[model samples]
Target chain A: MARREVSVLFFLALLCKAIAIRSQPSTIDASFCLSWRLAVETNNELPWRTVPNKCSQYVEDYLIHGQYERDLELIMEQALDYVNGISIVGDGKDAWILDVDDTCISNIYYYKSKNYGCDPYDPAAFRAWAMRGWCTAVPPILKLFNKLIDNEFKVILLTGRDKEILGQVTIDNLHNQGFIGYERLIMRTNIYKGQSAVTYKSNIRKNLEDEGYRIWGNVGDQWSDLQGYSFGNRTFKLPNPMYFVP
Target chain B: MARREVSVLFFLALLCKAIAIRSQPSTIDASFCLSWRLAVETNNELPWRTVPNKCSQYVEDYLIHGQYERDLELIMEQALDYVNGISIVGDGKDAWILDVDDTCISNIYYYKSKNYGCDPYDPAAFRAWAMRGWCTAVPPILKLFNKLIDNEFKVILLTGRDKEILGQVTIDNLHNQGFIGYERLIMRTNIYKGQSAVTYKSNIRKNLEDEGYRIWGNVGDQWSDLQGYSFGNRTFKLPNPMYFVP
Candidate 1:
C-alpha cells in the first residue's frame, strides 16, 4: 500500500513540474531581459520556441502583482522630470508621439492566453480581439498623457494598424479607454502599407516636423517606436517581451 | 521470461517511433507550400517552430534532389513569358530591379546548418559566412537578369546590406558568382540607417524614376523588396522560408 502511494505521489510531482515549466514566464529577469533588449536594438529577431521561450515567469508575476505598474510609474516619473526641463517654444506646436498598443493600452489579457512568443501570430484572432475594444488604459501612461494634454503639449497617436480597416474602431477603442484629445491619430495608409513600423512612424514624424510642429518627446514599448530619423528630443520605452512588431 | 521479451520489443518500437517523429518533415507539402507563399505575399514574417515547421520535408527533398532548381526553371520561364509580352521604352532608361540575396544568390548551405528557421539569426556568424563571399547563384534568376541586360533592360542591383561594411565584399562576391555588368549596385547607406527595407528600397526606386529611368520589372524573394509606391510595371518573387528582414 505504501509503495502504491509513493508511485502516485511521484506521478503527481512529474505532472506538476510539467505544468510549471509551461506556465512560467521564460524570458524575464535582469540578464536575459538586457540581452533581449540589446538583440531587439540590433535588429535581431528571436525564434519562437516550444520550450522556455522569451516571456518569463517574472513578467507574469510582475503583471499580476503590480510590479509592472510600479515600473511604469517610475518611468513616467522620469519622463515628467524631462518634460519639466524643456521649455515650449511654439504655441501648441510642442508635440509628443505616443504608440497605441501596450503603450497607452494593455494587451496583457490577449497575451496571457497566447503563451507570449510560443504561438504564431493569428491576425484574424488579433483583429477580433482588437475590435472588442475592451483593453484597459495603462495607468501610468494614461496619467502622463493627461498631464501632457493639461500642460498644452500636442499628443499624437501612431500605430501600424491599417487605416482603412482598423482606423475608426481603434479611435473608438482609444476614446472608450479614456484616451482623448490628441492632435492626430495616424494609421498606415495603403501608400505606406508593408512599411516597417520604424519607417512608417519616422516618416509621419518628419511630416509633422515639416508642418512646423516641434516634437519634444516620443514613447513606446518597442524600440522600433523610438529609433529613426527625426526622433524627437527624448524617448521612453516600456518592457514588452510578449510580442515584437518589426 | 516471455513477458520481459515482450516489454523489450515494445520499448524498442516506441524509441523508433520517437526518432521518426523528430526526423519527419512537417510543413513542406503542396497545400502548406501554397498557403505559406500566400502568407509571405501579404505579410513578411513566419515565426520559427521545432515541429512541423514552415519548411517542409518536401522542400528538403526538393533541394537535395534538384527539384528546387527545376521549379525555379519553371518560374523563370513564366517570368520570361511575361517580359516578352511587355514593351520597353525610354532608351537605356528602361530598368529592372533585382534583389541580391536569395533572388540572385542562394544561402541554402548556410540555412541548412541552422536547421532553417529553427535557430535564431546570428549576425556575427552570418557576416562571417557572407565575407567568404561564396554564396552561389540562384541559376534561374541569374539567367533572367543576364537575359534582361542582353535585351537592353538596364539591370539594377539592390540589397539591404550596409554599404559601409559589406559594399566592396558584396560587389566582389557578386562578380565572383558571375553576377556582373549591372547598371548600378545600390547598398544601404548610413544616411538611410534605421530605415525599413521597404522605405530604403522604395526611395531608391523613386530616385531612379526621378532620374528619368523607367522601371519595367522588379524581382525579389521578399515582398518588402517589391511592394511600395513607384514600383515597376511587373514583379516576380522567389521562394524563401528561411529568414525575414524588416
Candidate 2:
C-alpha cells in the first residue's frame, strides 16, 4: 500500500512538471501580441487605467526606490531641454515620443502569471482580463508624461500595444491616473496576421518621421522605439528589470 | 433617295443630341468610379506607372517641370536636418523619432489621384494592396535617408501603416532604395481607428518620448504628421499639393 501511494505521487509530480514547462510565461510576448492585435483590430481600445496586479508594488519598489525614477526624470529633463538635449525648443509645438507598456504602464504580472503567451487561448477569458483594466504607470515616468502635457509640449504615446483595446480601457486607465490627454496614439498591428513586430514598428516610425513632426524626445524600454528609417535621437531607457529583446 | 438621306441625317443628329449634355468624355464616369473604387478598396494601389495614358503625361510633366528637382532637394535637405535635429546632452545617451509616409517614401500621388482616407476601406483589396512589395520611396527622399544612414544616426521609421505588412513590402521598399541598416520601424495599426488622425498620431509619439528618445526632427507632409505625440525640433514638409482631408 505504501509503495503504491508513493508511485501515484511520483506520477502526478512528473505530469505537473511537464505542464509547467509547457506553460512558462512570456509577459512581453503575450502583452506584445495582445497590444498589436488590439491596435489593428480593436483600434487601441485598451482600458488604460486598470490597476495591474504588479503595478503598485512594482512602482513603489522598482520605480520609486529603483533607479528607474531618477533615470526617467533625467531622461525627461534632458528631453525637455530641446536644443541642449533633445533639441526641443520653445512652446507647445515641441513633440515627444513615449512608449506604453513597461515605460508607462505595468502589465508584466498579468502576462507572466497567466501564461498568456502559450497560445491555445480562450478569447473570452482574455477579454475578461482586459476588461479589468487597472494598471499603474512606472512611477516618475507617469508623472513625467503629465509634465509634458502640462508644459505645453506635444505628448504622444507610441506603443507596441494593440489599437483595438485602447479606446475605453486606455482612456479610462490614463484619465483615472491623471495622465493628461494626448495628441495621438500609434499602435502596432498585424497587417497580414503573421508579420514581425520589428518590421511593423520600424516602418511606421519611418512614415512618421517623413511627415515632419519635430520629435524632440523618445522614451521606451526597448531599442526599437528610438530607431526609425530617417530619425534617431536622444532616448531614455528605464531598466525594465522585467524582460525584452529576443 | 432624299427621304432615306434625311432619315440617316436625322438619326445621326439624334445620337449627337443624346451625348451633348455631358461635360467631358463618355468614359469619365467609368474612370472616376474606377479610380474611386481603387482608392477606397485597394488602399491607393492604382498603377499610375502602368497606365500609358494622359495621366502618364501629367505625371511626367509634373516630375520634369513642377519644381521636381528643387522640391526634391529641399525635401531631402529638410529630412536630413529633421533627423539631425535631436540630441541628448544632459543624459548618457539621446535618440531620434522619425515619421514615415511622405517623409520616407513618395506616396502622395497614389493617395491623391486615387483619393483615399484612413476610413472607408475595402478589406480584401486593401489587404492585397498592402502586401505589394514595390512600394518605393521618392528618389531624392531615398537619397536623403541613405545620407542619414551614412552619417551613422540610428534610423527609426514611425508611420500610420499597419505592422503586419512590415516584413516584405516596407523593408524591401526602403532597402531597395539603399540603407546600411535600420534600428526600428514603429507603426500604427487599427488602434484609435475612429479617433481624429491628430489624436491617434500624438498618442504614438508620446509613447516613444516616454521611452527616452531625444527626438531631433520629424519630417512629414500632413499637419498631423508634423504634430504627433512627439513634436520634433525641425519638421520638414514636402510639397503635397494634390490631396486634401478625407
Candidate 3:
C-alpha cells in the first residue's frame, strides 16, 4: 500500500511538470500577443491579413472577457465629452463620421467562428455573413450614435462594404440595431472599387467639405478610416484587434 | 481544545475575507488600467498630464517586468524590417529621424523616482535630471541606430530638449551610451520656445527636406514626434505610458 501511494505521488508530480511545460509557451505567447495588438492598434504594424495563429486564443480571451467592452466604454466616454464641448453650428451641416462594421455594429459573432481573425480572411464567407445581417449594435457605440443624433449632428455612416451587394442588408441591420436617424449610409460604389480605403474615404470627405459639411468628429475601429485628407476635427479610434482593413 | 480550534478557524476565515476585500478594488483597477494604457498607446486617449494614480503600480510593473523590453524588441524588429526594404538613394541624402528622449535613450531611471509618472510633471525637476545626463541607451534602439549608421543612412536625432540648457549634456549622454556617428542632433532653440512639439518637429523636418534630405523613416515614443507635416515615409512609435508630451 505504501508503494502504491508513492507511485501515485510520483504520477501527480509528473502531471504537474507536464502541465507546466504545456503552459510555458502559451504564457510567452500571451505577452507577445498583447504587444502585437498594441502595435496593430497604433498602426505600427500594418497591412496584415489576420491575427497570428499563436494569438488566436489570446485575442479570443481579450474579446470574450470584459476588457474589450471596457475599452469601448472608455472611448465612448471620451467621445461624449468631446461632443459635449462642441457648439453645434445648427446649420444642419455639422457632421460626425462613424465607420460601420466593428464601429456601429460588432462582427464578434462572425469573428468567433473565424478564430477571432486567426484564419485568413475569406471574402466570400464574410459577404455571405454580411448578407445575413446578423451583427448587433456595439452597445456603447449605439449610445454614441443616439447622442450624436440628439445633439443634431449629421451622423454619416461611412463604410467600405460594397453598395451593390451589402448595402440594403447593412441598412436593415443598422436600423434593426437602433442606428436609426443617421443622416447618410454611404457605402463603396463601383467607382471606388479598386481604391484603398484611405483614398476612397478621403475623396468622400473632401466631397462632404465641398458640400459645406463641417466634419466635427470621426470614429473608427480601423486606422484607414480615420486617416487621409479632411479627417474631421477630432478622430476617435475604437479597438478592433481581430483584423486590419488596410 | 475543540472550542479554541473553532475560534482560530473563524479568525482565519475573517482574515481571508479581509484580504479578498482589500484586493478586490486593485483587481478591477488593474483591468481598467490596462485598457487605459492601450488607449494611450493607440493615441485614442490624448492630452493627458501624467499616469493615472490608479495605474501607477500597473505602469511600474510593466516597466520593471520584461514586457516593456519585449514591446520595444517587436518595434525594433518591425523598424529593421522596414529599413531593409528601403532603396537608399546612396547620394548621402538618405536620412532617418529619431527622437532623443525616451526613444534613443531611456529616462526610466528618472521616471522610476517620479512614481513612474503618476506624479505630476515638475519641469524644473525634469530639467535638473536632464542636466545630469545619466540616461542609458535603449538597447534595441541603439542597435537600430548602429544599423542605420552601418547602412550609410544619415541618423538625425531630433529632440524637444532645450538646446541652450541640455544640448551638450545630451550629446555626451548619447555618446557614452554608444550612440555614435549620427548626422545631426537637433534640439529646441529659444526661437521655438512657445511652439508645440508637433509644430516644432514638423518645421525641422520641413527644413531637413528643404536641405535635400530624403526622410525615409521616423521613430519616436510620442505621437507628436511622428505627426504633422513631413512625417517621413514610415513612422514607428515605441511604448511609453509613463507620460505625455503634448
Candidate 4:
C-alpha cells in the first residue's frame, strides 16, 4: 500500500482504539458504582466520605428517579408490617427510634447542589442548609411515623444534629412537614460533642432504655444510625448512597 | 350501530382491559422483587421462606446472568482491600473466618433446580446435592481465600454444615477447588444441633477467640453467619438472596 493509505489505516485504527477505551470505563464504572452502593447499603463498605467521583451522575439519577422513592416505599411497607405484628402494650414507653436527617427529613435538595454527595461533606455548608429549615419530609417515613402514632406507639425523633444550633429549626421543620405528635425529639447536646455517630446515638438510645422505654423499631439512612448498642429490636436501613456519617 | 357491531366493540374493550390487567402485575412484581432482594441483603427484611412466588423469574435471572457474580466480585474486592490494610502481627493467631456454603462454594446449580430459591428449601434434596460434592468454587471468594493464605493470615472455614454428613465431602470439595493451605474447618456437630444459626456460629466464633485466634476478618453470605458475639474486627457480607438461615 502507498504511504498515504497506510497513514489513513493507522489513523482509523487509533480512532477505533480510542473509542474502545472511551466506552469501556463507563460500563465498568457503572457496574462498580452499583456494587459500591450495594456494599454501602449492606454495611460491607464503611467510612466512605463522599460518593465515588465516577458515580456522581449515577447517584444523582438514582436519587431523582423513581427507584429511590420505590425503595423508600418498600422499606416503609416492611416497617409498617413489622410494627403491626407487634402487640403494643398500650404503654407510653413503647418507642420507635427514627433518625432525623434522611430518615424523617431529606437533605437531597442541598445535596443536589453538592453533586448528590460527590463533594466532601462540608459541616458549615450543611449546617447552613439545615439552618434554612427547608428540608422536606421523606414521604414514606412520614406515613410510617403517622401510622406508628396511630397505633399508640411513641415516636422518638433521634438525630445527630446539634442541639444548640439546629434545635428550633429542626423542630419547626418537623412540624411543618406534618411530623406531629412525636413523643420526643432528641439531638446531640454539648455533652455528646465530638463523639462518633455510633457512640453518640448509642448513648442516647441507652438513655431511652434506661428511662424504661422499649425501642421496638429503629430506622435510619446510615448504618451508624442503626448499629451500636441499644439498636432496638429491629432496625430498618433506608437507602442513602450520599455520604457516610462516620 | 347493529347489535352484532356493538357486541364486537364490547368484546374488543373487554380484551383490552384483560390485557392491561395481565401486564400490570409483572411490572409491579418486578419492582417489588428487586426491593425485596435489597431488603434481604441489607437485613431489613428477615425470616423469609422462599423467594416470592411472583419473583421466580427475576431471582433466576439475577443468579444466572452475571449480576450476582459481579456483586460477589465487588464484595471480594472490598474484602481484599480491607484485609490488605490490616497489619498482621507476626504471631500465628491472626485469623480470617469464612462461611463455607455460599462464601467458598456456590450452590447455584442446585438452586437452579429449585427455581433460584423460589421453592421451599428441601433439606433431604439439598443434603443429597451436598453429599455428591459437586459444588463449584465461587471464583472471587476463592481468590480472596488464596490471597489471605498468601498474606500469612490463618484462614478458618467455619460453616453451618453438619459434621457427620458433610465433613469429608466439604474438605474434598475445597481441595478440588484449590482452597489449600493453612486453616481449620469447623462444622456443626451434635451439641449445636438445636441452636439457631446465629447461636451456633457465634458459639464457634467464641470458641476460636477463646483459643487465642484473633478474628481480624469474617466473610459470609448469611447475616446469621456474621452476626452475634465475636463477629470479628471487621465483617464482609457477600450477596445471598436465596433462603435465610434464621
Candidate with the greatest TM-score versus the true structure: 3
- Candidate 4: pairs in clash: none
Report lDDT per candidate: 0.72, 0.51, 0.90, 0.87
* Residue B223 Cα positional deviation in candidate 1, in Å, after optimal superposition: 0.6
- Tens-place lDDT per residue, model 4, A1-246, is 556655755665565555445434236676677788888898887778888889998888678866788889988888989988999877689999999999999999999989999898899999999999999999999999999999999999999999999999999999999999999999989999999999999999999999999999999999899888999999999999998888
Off by over 4 Å in 3: A1-26, B1-26
Considering only chain B, report the TM-score of each candidate against the true chain B. Answer: 0.80, 0.60, 0.90, 0.88
Predicted candidate 3 versus true structure: per-residue lDDT over A155-218, tens digit per residue? 9999999999998899999999999999999999999999999999999999999999999999
Task: Name the runs in model 4 displaced over 4 angstroms.
Answer: A1-27, B1-29
Ten residues in a row with the worst lDDT in model 2 chain B? B40-49
Each model's total of backbone clashes: 8, 156, 0, 0
Cα lDDT of model 1 by residue, B147-215, tens digit: 887788899999998888888889998998888889999999999999988899999999999999998
Score residue B134 of candidate 3 by CA lDDT.
95
lDDT of 3 at A215: 96
**Candidates 3 and 4: which is better by DockQ?**
3
Error of 3 at A209 (Å): 0.9
Candidate 4, after superposition: displacement of residue B132 in Å?
Answer: 0.4
Ranking by lDDT: 3, 4, 1, 2
What shift in Å separates residue B244 of candidate 3 from its native position after superposition?
0.8
True-vs-predicted CA distance for residue A16, candidate 3, Å: 9.8
lDDT of 3 by residue, B1-246 (tens): 356555754665565555445434236888889889888887878788889898898899888888889999988899999888888999999999999999999999999999999999989999999999999899999999999999999999999999999989999999999999999999999999899999999999999999999999999999999989999988998999999988
User: How well is each residue in B182-204 modelled by candidate 2, as lDDT tens digits?
Assistant: 66876656665566556776776
Model 1 chain A is weakest, by summed lDDT over 10 consecutive residues, at A42-51
lDDT of 1 at B34: 33
DockQ of 4: 0.22
C-alpha lDDT of residue A133 in model 1: 85
